[model samples]
Target chain A: MTMTFDQPKTRTENQTRTGATVEFRGLQRSFGNVRALAGLNLTVGRGELVALLGPSGCGKTTALRVVAGFEQPDAGEVLVDGQDITRVPAHRRDAGMVFQSYSLFPHLSALDNVAFGLRMRGVGRAERRARAGELLDLVGLPDQADRYPHQLSGGQQQRIALARALALRPRVLLLDEPLSALDARVRLSLRDEIRRLQQELGITTLFVTHDQEEALSLADRVAVMNAGRLEQCAPPAQLYARPATAFVAEFVGVMSRIPARADGATVHVLGRTLPIDGDPAHGDVDVLLRPESIEVVAAADGSAQVLGAAFLGAITRLSVRSAAGTTVKVDVPSPAATTLPVGSHVELALPDRPVLVAPRKEQARA
Target chain B: MARLAMAVTALRGRIRWSRGVVLLIAGTYFLLPMVCSVVFSIDVPGQGVTFDAYTGILGADGFLDSLTLTLELAAATVVSVLLLLVPALITVRLTAPRLRWVIEVVCSLPLVVPAIALVAGIGTVLRWGPDHLADTPLYDTFIAIQDPDFPVVLVLAYTLMALPLAYRTLDGGLAAIDLKVLVEAARACGANWPRAVLQVVLPNLRGALLNTAFLTLALVLGEYTVAAILGYRPFAVWIVGIGGSQAEMSVAVSVIGLLVTWVLLLALATAGRPRSARTKTTAETS
Candidate 1:
């Protein structure tokens, strides 16, 4: 059967397909002395894709596990569709999970692996087989139904895993670094396909990953976490542009710390003043600038000297040392790095966009 | 070129000598006893070559009885060991992984305990059993242990002795697959513990199960010490008793037993191989 993914309307316009709302309230989990989730509270809106993004050991996965009913929280409740399901067994929770390792049953063919959940639910064999075939077609792997896991490629295995997870038509989907195990090229294409499918189904999904770019690209809302707590939760653009805390700003993207002085809502950095979100005490602080915001020009009388340059396809990242002996990274187009090679003097300039600032550290002895 | 040819010839000569020596030793070790027994059993010197002893087994009174009893014992041992082991190992591996060392130690204790020593210990235990269960339903079981028609004690003893080999085979199979992941996946698909074990775990372990069963069968067929001491005439004990009055018949039975065990082992080796290995060539042709 050929399954067509022809949902051309935006996810918001396709609001006719309703999805469940999932909420984790004050979830606390600990393994011995290490706290996995310290009072983590977050809610996923109906038909929205929320990503829990963090470094390893930041409890992003633990939060997803609690929602999936694989783990029990020590002092909290998980509510799905506004009803508490904290005590529900994993099999009864009606949540489908796609693990990082594919986790396909090796002995079963792809069709059987996809049909497994329906079989367990007591669906007729013919009906389950038809449904599984439709799911495989949906993932663009219709002909791979008869192939075993070992007979398929890594990418094919992951697609089969995803199809299996969606076969049950679960109310909520949980993905734990599903694309991290693949190569770079496959990872990109598969992630886009996943986003399209998730939107088509309109299932409220919680994807956990340490890759910031993936979280930003696939999630409707990205929740950056650190130390078992959410640092910020917002749309990708907002989380990248206007991070609520220093940790969120640093984790979401690359940021360069430059000495600056804060005067009310404006901060002065690199011999220029820029606007910030809120009014802070008029004192010395460190300004955080995105590499794209910093411009570099080669000039003999410049105060900064280029220390190194790395050509990264469209943009070249340059490491420069300021007159005060502090290192700052700036990204420029490829052609610009050729003229401003290593040891070349260059002037650093900031754009009009706002920059984040934190308290300045004590100067290191030069 | 001449020197190189001489060196090559020397290497070939050395390889041939070693291969011939090994072949001769192995051929003698395996075939010598069968050859001697065949010759000895058939040679009724004054009566010339005859098949008397081989034919005598058919007319022997207890031959069929002992053989049937041993077959029954083998079946019981295979089933009881599987029922006792498969679930316990799966549970221990999946749920209480910390108890793995203890299970391994207990299963392997039979290997260290000699068969004669085990029989002596079992005799003492059975002697104490009657007095303790004199007024209970268990008294009937103690009495049934002495039955010669279908001895249950031999089954119990064979099952215990087969534990170490069965455990190793099953553990090897379990190690080959990601048991925890498979079981958890089954559970997530809405399977209960029993359903998961029966349908998911056991089917994947077909090879291990067959290997353990056949190994237990072979062990039951060949064991003699405990049955002889218990005054039970199992196949092994029966063959020895026949030897007292009819030496040639005993050798004939021994040859049959050896052939039976070889067939079982051969079947075990091929049973668990991947199905694709057999069908790939056919698919290629089609």
Candidate 2:
């Protein structure tokens, strides 16, 4: 009967007890002509949740599989807690993995399914069942243990998969797109559940997902991969705020490509010369400005017009075509939704700080 | 209301007629022969609804022996094929992919060589083995295809025919399984490869195994050419012994063969039912 979602500490820190560290040195994999992973190097510190975020076939899953030992890298080593485990078989590596399908043994009751790994280890029936019972309780489903896997909802099945993985108390946890199968609300709630559990157990977990919002919301750091290469690896906030490459900027979060020409000390934008971040590589430049950095004011005394408006619940995304015929997307609070109409003149404001800029050729389509 | 109801009734009549036409043709083609067999099995020419055909076959001196031998051969083919195909498939995939391909080619070689070729070639070799096996009546009597010894050579030959189908079906089953789940789950629990294969791999494939076994059974039972050429007697060859006059006997064997196939289909259905708990229990318990 207790409502716990509003509590400050309920979501992030109760379960991540003692996290483990994972290190990969020069991991390489290839499939025919496709170079899936080439000399990839990454280190995940203890108690940190790092998301290997990339589009499909970007070598993120390959890296996760290699760590799980489901795949053997063509070269390089995988080390967990300073132990070389490149050759260690997946099951012997002491890492718990939760698959996207929630691959629970469909024929076993939830309780017995959770206890399967322990039973295989020859743990006596009484002790294993007791431990399994405790895990089911922890995931908030003690009553459903007797039900078969098919009898549970998608969310419940996922919780059982997690409990089964945790049953063995593995050092490093591997989650392969674990919540990509759920409905939006279920996904949000389960993500919070995962964040909470990781905090409590402090288990060193490697999560692989194609979702950028998921990576930003959950991980300590996000590693972006493109065509089997790691483009950038840093804290989520830092990576989102200051992406190392044009790919990182476009892939990590939303941004708009605004045309600008570098004119020595100043750049030409907004039909007026303005200054932005970095020294250019000469020629025409393209500056990447975040939508949050742009503001709309009434025009005539205005510099822009609202070309289109879209309602997004709490926010309204406005498509504004500037005086120079450049289109930009601006997100504003939903309360301003009715006030901003198409063809209405509006003035665009820029923040005082430096904005991310690159050459038109260097800027990714955003 | 009257017009709508009349229209609906006419529409229903049209629907039934369209459905009935296809059923009528199919039923006449397949069931007429089957109905005739039942009628023949019990008819007494002048007398109505009699069991003379049944008694006549049972009363015939060697008919029981031939029937018994046919059943024996079917059982043998099921057993031998199981012994050969399952292990062969297991090792084939477990080996290198290249080597597995070679084994696959070898298993399928029988298809290229006809059963008659196998019988002719082996029959010739056996005839030349130190002494001509055909010189003894044992060779001649065993060739009576429904004799107990018919399936020895019969099943062995059918194994070749049955193997490709069995291997392919089983291979499909093995491919469909989440092998990683089984192997990793077992390994984490500390079970080794053989144990994992037995407990995990084989059970999931029970449906395919049973299906192949049944198909193999039917094939061995009905096999005529190889048994005839090799001078052995299977049910098909034995039924041919009545020289087209004992159409009733032939009909009887066909009916039994059909029933066996159905039994096997049921077995296959049973095998596929989810038993992950009990299966795991028995696997661990033993």
| C-alpha root-mean-square deviation, each candidate | 4.1, 6.9
On residues B200-225, what C-alpha lDDT tens digit does candidate 1 reach at each position? 78878888999999989988888999
Q: Give the runs in model 1 whose Cα sits over 4 Å from its true position.
A: A5-18, A279-284, A361-366, B1-28, B38-58, B279-286
Q: Which of the numbered candidates is closest to the native, going by highest TM-score?
A: 1
TM-score of each: 0.90, 0.79
TM-score of chain B of 1: 0.90
Summarize candidate 2's per-residue lDDT along A50-154 as a digit string, tens digits: 999999999999998888777889999898888999987665777777888657765567898788777766778888887788778777888877877766899
Best by lDDT: 1
lDDT per residue for candidate 1 within A3-23, as digits (tens), equals 453332211223344468999
- As for candidate 1, its clashing pairs are none
Every model's DockQ, to 2 decimals? 0.47, 0.24
Q: How accurate is candidate 1 locally (lDDT)?
A: 0.85
